[model samples]
Target: MARKLNDIKSDVDEKRFLFHQFFYKNIDADIEIFISHLEKLTKVFIFSGIIRDFFVFKNQKPFRDIDLIIEEDLVLEEIFPALDFKKNSFGGYKIKFKTVDIDLWVIKKTWALNQGQLKFKFDYLNALPKTTFFNFSSILFSLETKEFITGKDFLRFLRDKKIELVLKENPYPELCIVNSFYYSDKLQLDMGDKLKSYLKSNYTSKMNVESIQLKHFGKILYSDEYIRNKIEEMFTN
Candidate 1:
């Protein structure tokens, strides 16, 4: 049986629009209480790909999930029940909170022998900017819960400052580290040094250099060589 193309398009469109409504308009008690609870935590950051959704895309829509960071080891099971969420030890929480799905991860920092300084890594997801779902109010609650929205907000905030580069570029050093990870072998002589240098200046520590070198290295390291080659090929084309 042949399916109508318009039907598929309609389905996708409906989902997108419905998702938008869930974010901008929907507010519920479960979400509200969740936010209120998060407000009390200290040393937490609300980040992950969800933050990317806010920073990179249009429409300040409510995300389908959230990625929260808690520096101290509190039991997710103990804390998240008020919101109809459950805890699991892959180092995260799973919640059937409301209309949306919520996957919450706990953050624990560890020591790294490779570097003298503590390598602030995600013990939960081994990734940053984790994704989970919440209502608009829940997201607002999470933001207030951690008081670390400043890092995520910085992305949008920087655009207003006329910084001319991505603002999230500052706190998210992993985007840069991935490059060093892949390129380390190829440029073994310089890779380690460069990785350390990039991490220290960009990720581990902080710096402000009004040039695109760090980003360039990141692209060169992590992005596909074919893409790089294709862009170079464009000039000849």
Candidate 2:
């Protein structure tokens, strides 16, 4: 779904890029609304899938969830008295902001200590990029400021319009697997040869692609839509 800037010669592509840039600029406005509700939070950032879809992947589908992280944990009930928030099966709060849902996660402490998840200190800004599956997905925008941080190869990968799977110590392989499936088949994206090869070698066993699907297909995936829909359904109670 991402086209290299050099390859985008048509007016339509130019318009699309401008629209994306516009969204990026206005994203903090929505984020500010969330920040206003919270008390004394020194640092706040919304990262991962939302940033990737809006800026890097440039998918046609609207963003399903904005993954929020804060420097300190705040009780959701205190912030929004009018609405109910559902706790994700994972340790986080899932609450809708108007029509869009935001998955609020915490890294302020060592609290959500699950196996295969990355660990970070309270104000460790660089920790954002270290937790993502792909370099391009590692960008994060500050909810309180104009500053942002990106993965090491994020710029190069975007300029090249290549889909790459990061092999460096992945804390979330399950997320990576589900993401690759969604992007390649659901989004109708063409995978780079390296990405394809890595998926085959690491994900496939004994060349049995069908079996791989059989194991993962029906299981819960960590995609944005998956998280959003589940949270939406929970609020019906």
Candidate 3:
């Protein structure tokens, strides 16, 4: 059963336990072992989509990928000496396990934060939420502490099943626009006014469909016509 927002908000300990349980059960056994081993080296966090999916679908839906934030600066090769890892364009390391792919990076090297696109007065963990494009993708689960760190409106938006733009100024506005529609459709969530307006203003004929495809590793979810019609419907509605 999906957890109610009220119940989740009411009990932090239970929610933490549930999050850990969901993560351990759903993730591949080998990947779990990798994460456990990595945590011994540095503070690691499981962030964004997977965490949100846990709240929305629990163990019902399979996870697409895992995003990890490492608190300490360490050489990836030193830690995973035997495993093969590739560097992503955004300065993260990508490791593909048997069933799922993992993206790991130092918290300070987060694209938006590293480029100064997003600013925070507090630490990286606190600033992590502000780096996301959507409120639902802004929560993080600490692998070491067994706690959750959520952004503003994270719970409220999740409860409403609404997709709201949390960070408007992003390095990849086009990708963010594509993700807005992608997540909205995939999660069966409604788009908020801010996101609707942003999409309307930022979407253009020159938008690179090929680039979007490449970002998703050539996997096309929504067709060009489908995305165009969806944006057009946004304006009409």
Candidate 4:
């Protein structure tokens, strides 16, 4: 019931699918609270892996958290003042309420991060990669539509895929190394030689070999194992 890259974009069909996933699992109590709060927000979207996990596959792990992106950072502070929220080194705010850790991310309009940059004009899609669904990061369920918007390469996970690296502005450093290793090990795909050099020269060079060894391959054994299983299921059967 999910939309593919080639599917016609229609609000009616999309509303139906969102409703389907809304009932696929008992909505996490905290997420239910978050959804109820959505009526008060403006230009907000839930751009997390969970939407894809529930809508496309319906085989995802039970609720751990949800990531929401809002147009205004100040409005969030005003809305959820009672909740404990902290801005992290990454461009996101961690809002904890009961069992839910809702990541409140602000969307700056500028696609590229640079000094003296004016916000309120950037597209969120530019930050995400054109890789497999595991790395296809912009699966946003906009509150305006009440449905998910698939990324440009969402269906490429079903094919022999190529990764395009426009990473000079990439904010998530972990993806450059951890995800590169993940795809190479599990999917028989290598980080294209250009990105390999870019990573080595820019980010990966600073780490000690042991640290790199542990983080690059270690996240799979720890938090990302389910992504591995889901990938296997999608690629195999």
Using lDDT as the measure, the top candidate is: 3
Q: State the lDDT at 32 in candidate 2.
A: 51
In candidate 3 the C-alpha lDDT for residue 15 amounts to: 80
What total of clashing residue pairs does each candidate reach? 12, 0, 0, 3
TM-score of each: 0.38, 0.60, 0.89, 0.61
Candidate number that wins on lDDT, 1 or 3:
3
Segments in model 2 whose C-alpha atoms lie over 4 Å from true places: 1-32, 56-62, 108-123, 167-175, 185-189, 192-194, 201-237
Residue-level lDDT of model 3, residues 67-152, one tens digit each, is 89898877888778887799877778988888888888899888778888866656878888887888887788888888888775
> How much lDDT does each candidate structure score?
0.39, 0.55, 0.80, 0.51
Model 1 misplacement above 4 A: 1-27, 41-44, 80-83, 109-237
Candidate 2, 1-237: lDDT as tens digits: 666534532322344445445545544565556566652555667666765565545543456666777767666677677665888655678776665677777754322233335655353566656555565665666645544566654554565655666543554444455566666554344556566555544543223333344564554444445434433443464
How does candidate 1 score on lDDT? 0.39
Residue 73, model 3, lDDT: 77
TM-score comparison, 3 vs 4, better candidate: 3
| Candidate 1 Cα RMSD after full superposition onto the native fold (Å) | 15.5
Can you rank all candidates by lDDT, best first? 3, 2, 4, 1
Per residue, candidate 1 scores C-alpha lDDT tens digits across 1-237 of 534544533433344433434443544666656645765764445454444344335344455565555556666566664556665535566667666656554544311211223333433322232221111101211343222222222332223321112212233344444433433342232322223433445432232221233554433333344323433443465
Say which candidate scores most in TM-score.
3
